[model samples]
Target: MDGQENEEHANRGEDVPATDRAPRPAPRRDGAGRTGRRALRRTGVILAVLAVALVGVVLGVLAGGRVSTDIGPFQADLSVAPAFGGGTKVDIPPLGALLLDSHDGPTHLTVELGALDQSRTEALLDDPASINRASQSAVDDVREGVLRLGLRTLASAVLVTLLLALLVFRDTRRAAWAGALALVVTAGSLGTAAATIRPEAIEEPRYEGLLVNAPAIVGDARRIANDYTRYAEQLQRIVGNVSQLYTTVSSLPVYEPAPGTTRVLHVSDMHLNPTGWQLIRTVVEQFGIDVVIDTGDITDWGSEPEASYVGSIGLLKKPYVYIRGNHDSGRTAAAVARQPNAIVLSNTTTTVAGLTIAGIGDPRFTPDKNTSPAGSGLTQQTADQLIGVGDQLATTVRSSPRPVNIALVHDPASAGPLSGTCPLVLAGHTHDRQVSKLPEVPGKGPTQLMVQGSTGGAGLRGLEGEKPTPLTMTVLYFDKDKLLQAYDDITVGGTGQAQVNLERHVVEDPQAGVPAPVTPTPTR
Candidate 1:
C-alpha cells in the first residue's frame, strides 16, 4: 500500500518524501569542482618533485664543489656550500682554522691547505725575486681556481636536479624547469658571494688552532694592510727563518727525562695575553708538567671584564696554583678559584702535585687607582709594606703542618722576608728572570729565590720599547724530596719575529742530602 501511495504521489507530479522513491540522478560534478581537484593534485606533485630535486642538487654540490690549486708553495682546496652564515674559513690542517667574517649571506667558503712543496719552500729561503713571483702566481691561481670551481659546482647541481626531476615527473619539460631553478640558485649564490667579497676581513681574522701563532704567521695587520708586497716578503722571510731554526734544533741532542721527577711550569706576568696560555699549554704538554704556578699579573687591569681570562685555568687539566699580583683583585682571585683545577693561595698553605706550597697576595692593588694608597705606595706597596706582608706570609708557612717546599709572592721586594722561611721562594713583578741565593741566614742553609720574567712578553706595554720583549717561561724539575733539581728557560720571539732560545740550569745545593732547616723569619 505504501508503494502504491508513492506511485500515486509521483503520478500527481508532486514532491514525494514518503520512503524516497528511486534516488534522483546523482548530482553531476560542476566543471569548477573538477578543475579545483585537478589543480590541488598537480600542486602537490610539483612540490614533491621540487623537494626531491633540491635534495639531489645539494648533495651533488657538496660532493663536487671543491677544486685544488697551488697557492705559493702550498696546495690548497677551495670549496663553497650553503650555510647559516656567509664567511670564509681558511684551514691549516694540524694547526687550526682562521674564520673571517667576510660577508653577510647564507653561504660559506673554505680554503684548506692540503700540502706544501718542500723544494719550493726551501728555495724560497734564498731567492728574493722568486718569492715575489710565487706570490703573484698564487694570486692568479686562486682567482682561476675559484672561477673554475664555481662553474663546475653549478653544472653538477643542474645535472643532478634534472636527473631527479626526470625520475619523478617522467617529462623533459618539467625536468628542464627543475634544472633551471637549480641553475638560478647556484648562480645567485656564487654571484652574491663574489659581489660581497670582503678583502679587508683579512685584517682582523679570528684564528683557531695554535692561535697564539697567528700574529707571527700573519704579521702585523696594520703593517700588512698598508703594504701587501711587504707583507708577502715578510711572510716569506719568516717561513725561511723558522724553518732554519727548526732544522738546527732538530739536529741537537734530545734530553731524557729523569725518573721519579715532578715537572712544574712557572709562568708569570701574563698581563691578559692569550699567547701566554698558548706557551703554557705548549710547554705543559711537551714537558709533561704536573703542576702550574703563576706568580701574578695575569691581567693588565684586574677588572671584572678581565676575570674571564682565568677561565682558561681549567683547560690545563693540571693543578694550577696561583698567587695574586699587584694587578689582581679579590674579584680576580674569586674567578681563579671558580676554576676546577685552580688553587688560589692567599696567606695560606696547600699541597699541590705532592709539593707543599704557600703564597701571599700582593699588599697593594696598583691598577685600581681609587682603592690604592697615595705617595710612593700609590702604584704598588712601599718596600716597608712589602716586607711586612712577607713576614706575615713567612709566619704562616712556619706554622703549616707540612714543610713548605715552595713560597710564591708577586713582588720580589716582599719576598725578602720570606727568605729562609721556605726552601724555594718564587716571585715575578720585576719582568726579569733572576735566580739568586739570598744572604745567608743564621742557623739556616742557603735559600733559593727565583724571579720569573714576563711570560706574556710584558703584554702591550712591551711594544713601547725599541724591540718587543721576548716571551719567557720556565720548566722546573723537582726530585722526590720536592727540591729543585733543574730548570729549562724558554724564550720565544714576540710578534714580528721568528726566534726561540732555550737554556738549561742545574741547581747544586751545598748540602744536597739534608733539607734546609726552617727558621723563624726575622722582621726587617
Candidate 2:
C-alpha cells in the first residue's frame, strides 16, 4: 500500500501491530471540555469563599455577640450562640442559670444579670410604683440591647469576611460576595431567633445552680398566666424566702438525727405528674427519710399509659409503700408492685423500717371521665365501699402478731373503722390536708387520721381551677417505739408563686411521754 493509505490504516488501527502504529497526536480541547474545566474552577472558588465566610461570621459573633443593658433595676448582658435546642438562659452570675424551654430553633439566647444597681433597687423598692415603670422599661431596654448586638454582629461579620476573602482570593469581587453572604446569614439567624422566642416560658423556668438550696431559692414552675397580683406576691415571697434560705443554709449545724428516730415521708395523689416524683425524691433526700408511704391516687386514670409513672417508685431508692386510690385500678396496683422498691398494700399488713404498717386500697375507681361534681366528694356508694375496705384493713391489722403502727387508706371515712386498731391511720382522697382525732373504739390506742393533700398539685386537672393547687407532702418523725413524735407538712405554692412553707407540728404522744400537742409553726 502507498504511504498515505498506510498512515490512514494506522489511524483507523486496521492493519498495524500496536508498537508499529504511530503515536496519535494530542486531541485538541473541545468547547464542552473547556466549559467543564471552567465550571469546576468556579465551583472550587465558591466553596472556598463559603467556608471562609462561615469562619469569619463565627469569629465575628464571638467578638461582638454580647451587649450590656439595664433590665429593671438590674444590669445584664445579652448574647446569642448556636445550640442544638433553642432556649433562653438567664445566668445569675455567682449563683446559676435559669433555663426556659421557650422555643424550637438552633439558637440559644442568654441574659446574664451581672449586677444590681443598689441605689436604683432601693429607690424602686421604696416607691412601689417605680417597679411598674421599671418593668415597663425593661422590655424597651432589652430590645435596644438586642438591636445594638445585632448591628455589631453584622458589621463584624461583614468586615471579617471581606478581609478574609480579600486576603485569600486577592479579588475585590469575591471579597464583596463573601461579605454580602455573611451579612445575609447573620441577619437571617438573628431574625429567626427573635421570631421564635417564647416569652411565656418564664412561667416555668428550671434552675441549674451549684447550691443545693437552689430549689428553695427558685421554686418549681408549673403554669401561671395573667395573674399579676399573684406574681407580685410571689416575687416578694421569693425575696424573703431567699434571704431566709441563705441564712439557714449558711448556718446549718453539723448535727445528727435523734437516736432510734425514723423519718417517714407521707406523699399522696401524685396523679401521674412527673414533677411530683422529683419533689418526692428531693424531700426524701433532704430530710433523710427512711420510708415513704403513699396513701393513694398515684394516677388519675390508672390506665396503661399512666402505669409508667409508677416506675419512678424504683428511683426513690427507699422503701415505697403504696395503696391504690379511688382513681387507681387493680392494674395500677400490679404496676406499683412490679417496681423494685415498691410494696403494694391491698388490705394487707407489711413491716418496713422497723414498723408494722397495714394498708387497704380504695375500692372505688372514679377516673376523670367517670367523675362528676357531686361524686368528687364522697358519695354513698363510695362511702360504703370505703367502709368495707377499711374493715378488711382493720382485720389485717388485728391478725398481725405485731401491733400495727400505721394504717393506710384512700379515703378519710375509710379510716373510721380502722380507728383504735392502729395508732396512726393515713388516708388521702379529698385533695385537702387535714388531721383528725378519731373517737375511741374498743381497741389498742387512740387513732389519729392524717389526710394528705395532692402531692402532684392534683396533676393537670389542677390547672382547670381559678388558681392552681399547691403540691403538699408530709414528713412524720417516729420514735424508736414506732410512736409519732412530730411531723412537718411541706406546702409548695403552685405556678406563678415561689413559696415553700414547711410547718412543724409536734404531736403529744402519751406513749412518747409528751403532754400536749404544740401549735404548728411555719419553719420556712
Candidate 3:
C-alpha cells in the first residue's frame, strides 16, 4: 500500500469508506508507513518476543518451583481415601474423591506436594515399608515445576507479543512493556506469597494441625499460581467469584426506635469486602450506633489466607460486637482478639451498657487440633489449642453473673434447646441459608435469630436448603426491660432499611468498659 493509503489504514484498523472494496490495499504486509515506521515494524517483533520470553523466565524463577511427577503411576481415583500405610488420612475436598494408597511393601511414596510434614513425616519414612523419604525433594520439585510453568507461560506471551508488536503496535516497546509488566506482576506476587507462605507452611502445613484437613491447603499456593498464570477462569473462580453475593431477606424488623440508643445497625458476614466494611462504618456514623455485634467468619480460612485476613482487617475497626463465620482464618481471629479496642469473648459474658453478651460455637463442629470450640478466647487465648472450646464455652457462661444475656456464636446449630434461656442469641455461620421465621422448638423461649450474609454465603448461588447454606446477618436492639426485644434484618448486598423499636440499656462498668451482660454472648 502507498504511504498515504497506509496512513489511513494504520489509523483505522479497518477499511476506510470502502467504496470499491478492493481487498483493502493488500493489508499492509510490509512497512506501509514511513521508513522509520517500517524499520520499527521489522525490529519490534524480534525485540518484543525476546523481551516477553525473558520476562517469563524471571517470573518463573522468582516464584517457587512446582514439582511435576514425571515417572510412575501415582494415580489414585476419587473413590479412594487419601491415606497412608498406617491409615493416616487427608481430605482433598470440593474437587472430588481421591486415590490414596500404599504402594509395594511399606508404601513409601514421595510426592512433591509442598505440604507433607518432615518430622512426623520422617517418622513414617523410617518404616521399612516407606520408600518416600519426605524431604527437600518435594520442595525442589514444586519450585522447579513452577519455574517450568512460568517459562511456558512466558513462551505463550512471547508469541502473542510478537504478532501484536509486528502488526498492531509497529513498535516493540508496547508489547514488550506488556510482557514485562506481566512478568513483573507475576514475580512480585510470587515473591510476596513466598515470604508470607513461611517456613511453617513450607516445612509442613499439611500435616501440621490436623492431618485430615491438610491435603486441601497443601497445594493451594501452587494451584492458585497456576490458575492465575494465564489469567484463567479457575483463577477468577477463586478471587472474583468470592464476592458479589446475596441472601434471603428476613421479614423481622430489627428494632423499633426507643429512647437511649441512637441507631442500631445489625450486620454480619461482611466477608473481606472493604466497601461492605465501609457500609457499617457509614451506618455507625450515620445512625449513631451504640453497640455493633459481629456474628462470625471475619476472616476466610482464618490465617491461612492472609491476603483476605489483612484486607478484611482494615474494613473492620469500630466499637462493635463481632462473631465468627465459618470462613474465618486463623490470622484474622488473632488480629481481632489482639486489638486493644476489640472485645473478644468466647463463651464468657461481657456486660456492655447493662446488656449481657455471651458467645459460643464455631462453624466447624469437629475441633481440629488447631482451634478450640468457641475459638481462641477473644483472639489471643492460646488455651484453646489444648483444652478444647465447646466444653470451655459451657464453663465460661457459668462464670458470668450478668442479668441480661446476649449470646454470640459462629453457627446457628449451636442455638440448641438450652439457647433460648439466654434471652437474645446472635449467630452468623448459617449465612442466612434458610429464611422464614424459624418456629421455636417446644421448650425454648422466643429468641430472635439472624445469620449474616456473605458473598461467600450459599444463598446467591441457590437455595440454602439445597446444598450450601445461605448467608445473612441479624440485628437486635435490646430494651431497658432486659427482655429480648426489637429486631431488624440486614441482607448482604442489599440497600434499604426498616425502622425498629429502640431501647435504653444501663450497665455496671468494668475496668475494660462494662461487665458481662446478664446473658452470655460469645464473639465469634
Candidate 4:
C-alpha cells in the first residue's frame, strides 16, 4: 500500500501522508464494504460449487446412458428392405460403431433405441423418468431450484449476520438458526410446488394414451405392441371415446380442375402413419376420385422405431402418386413401387389419366445430413428416403418412353429448378399447421405450389401447446388448361390424434379428359 502511493507521488510530484498522520478508512461501519465483500466471497464459493456439481451431473449422465432398458417383445429387429423406398436404397448403420441389432439381436425397441441419441434416451429413462417438465425440462427445473435455494440461503444468512453484528457472538448463533429456518421453509415450499406442477411419467404404465405427453407420441406404436402381446385382449377396451370427438373439426382441400375441376383427393406428410394409410382406402372409395397424390413424408423416421406401427398400415390402398417428405423413411414409397398403382415423382413428371403431375421430394435448401435427426429432428437414414424418391424421378425421366411428367417432393424449396417446366407442383413439408396459403413460386405453373396438409395428426404432437391440427387432404384437377377450380378445406378433427376424415370438392364436371368451368376461389 505504501509503495503504491510512493510511485504515484514520485510521478506526480506529490507528498505522501505519514503513517501516523494518514487517515484510516473510518472502519467502513455504515458502508459495510467488508460485509459486502464477505458476502460476495460466499456467493462466489457457492457458484463454483454449483458449477462443479453440474459438471458432475453431465458426466454421470454420459457414463450411465440409458443404463439398462427393457422394451419387451416388440423390441425385435425389423429387417428393413431397401426395395421399400427403391432407387438403390442405402441402409442406415446404427450409431456408426454400435450395432443395435447385434447383441441379443435386434428388437423392435432396439430400433427405437438406436434412433435416439444415447444421452437423450438415458435422461428419458431416469429412474422414475421425471414427467414434470420432461427430460430437458426437468434438468432446467432442478438447476433453477438449486440456484434459487442457494441464493435464498445466502440472502438470509447475510441479513441475519448484519443484524447480529450489532450484538455479541452469543446472539449470533440465534440469528444463524433463524437463517437456517428460512432456508428450510423456502426449500419445503419450492419442493411442494415442483411436485404439484409435475406431470406423471409413463414408466410402462399400461399406457392407453389419455393425454398429450411422450407416451401419446408413440400411441400407435404402443397399441401395436399391445395387440401382439394379448393377441389384442385390450383391443376392445373402450376408454373415453376420442372417435366421437373428431366430428367437431372442419375439413378442406386445394385441387386444380382443367377449367373448372372438383372432387379431387390430396394427402401430404403422410409420414406413412397407418392411420393415414387406412384413411386413404376410405377416401378413394367414398370420394370416387380420379386422383390421389401424397406431397411427401411417406415413410422413413430415422429407424424402424415407427415402423412397428406399420402392421395395420400396409393394408391401406396405394395412392395414385406420392412425393417424398423430409420425414419419410422411404418404406412406404418402396412398397408402393412394387405395384403399378403407386408412383413416386421426385424432379420429373407423372400423368394420372393424362393429368400432368410434377413433384420434387424434400428438395435441397440443405444437405441431407442436416435434414433428418437434427434440424428436422429425424435421422439421416430417413432423410435418405426422400433422396431415393429424387433418384427415382431422375430414373423415371430417363427410363420411360412416355413423358409422364408430374413432380413429387417433400420440400417446396427444391422445386426451384423444375418450376416453369411442370404445369402442376405439389408439396407437404409444411403440414398446413397455419391458416394460410404459402405456395409462392415462379416455377409452380401459373398458380402457386400446392401444400397438401396431413390427413393424420395421430399421436404426433405436444400436449397443451400444440394447436388442434385437423386431418385434411387436398386434390387438384387439371382440365385442358390445368387451372384450379374449387379448393375444398376438408378438416377432420376428433378422430383421436390419429384419425383422418376428409371430404372432396363437389365437382360439377366429371370427365375422363374434359375441362371444367373455372370458378374463383371461395371466401372462407
The number of clashing residue pairs in each candidate reads 0, 0, 82, 67
lDDT of 1 by residue, 1-524 (tens): 36788889889998788467665697877998999999999998778767866786687689788898888889899998888778999987544688998876666889998777878876776665577798778879888988989898999889888888888779898888788888887788778888898988988888875444558644688787789776777667755654554443333222345788888889998987666786677677767889999998887667775787788899999999999988888898999999999999999988988899999888878873233221234333376778888899999988999989999988887777776777888988878888777766788756778889999887766666778777888878888878887777777776445566777666656233222332221111
Better of 2 and 4 by TM-score: 2
Off by over 4 Å in 3: 1-256, 262-264, 304-317, 361-395, 433-448, 455-472, 492-524
Worst-scoring 10-residue span by lDDT in model 2:
246-255
| Model 3: lDDT of residue 370 | 38
Native-to-model Cα distance after best TM-score fit, residue 16 in candidate 1, in Å? 18
Better of 1 and 2 by TM-score: 1
- Candidate 4: segments with Cα more than 4 A from true spot: 1-242, 245-263, 300-302, 305-319, 330-332, 363-406, 433-445, 462-466, 480-483, 494-524
Q: How accurate is candidate 1 locally (lDDT)?
A: 0.78
Model 4: per-residue Cα lDDT over 1-524, one tens digit each: 56776778768987665762456674547568788999999787555434433333223222321222222211212221111111111122321111221111111111222233445434433422232224345445434533444344334434443343324224444445444443443344334433443122112333211122334444554466545534232221211123222222222233433443434577765543444654566555554566777665654353443444433333444346665555555654465455556676656566665565655556433313235321256457655554565455545544556643345656544443333433344666666632222334553333234566666642244112445456666545444444444444555552333333333344343221122343434222
Candidates in order: C-alpha RMSD to true structure:
9.9, 11.4, 25.1, 21.6
lDDT of 3 by residue, 307-390 (tens): 323334334445555555556554556666665446666566776666777765363522232333332233443333222543
Name the candidate that leads on lDDT: 1
Name the regions of candidate 1 deviating beyond 4 angstroms.
1-33, 51-106, 110-134, 137-180, 195-226, 234-402, 409-417, 434-448, 459-464, 471-524
lDDT of each: 0.78, 0.76, 0.43, 0.43
Tens digit of per-residue lDDT, candidate 2, span 1-524: 45687788878978855666667999886988999999999999899989988888887777777788888888899887766787888887444578888766666778988667989866764555555577679889988987887788778878888898899989999999899889888888777777887877877677764323345433454423566667666565544443343333233221244699999999998876666776787777777889999998887766665676688799889999999888888888999999999999877889999989888887778774344321356578766876888788888888899989999988787777887887888888778998878888764567888889999888766766778788898888888888888787887765434456666676665353232554444433
Query: How good is model 1 by TM-score?
Result: 0.54
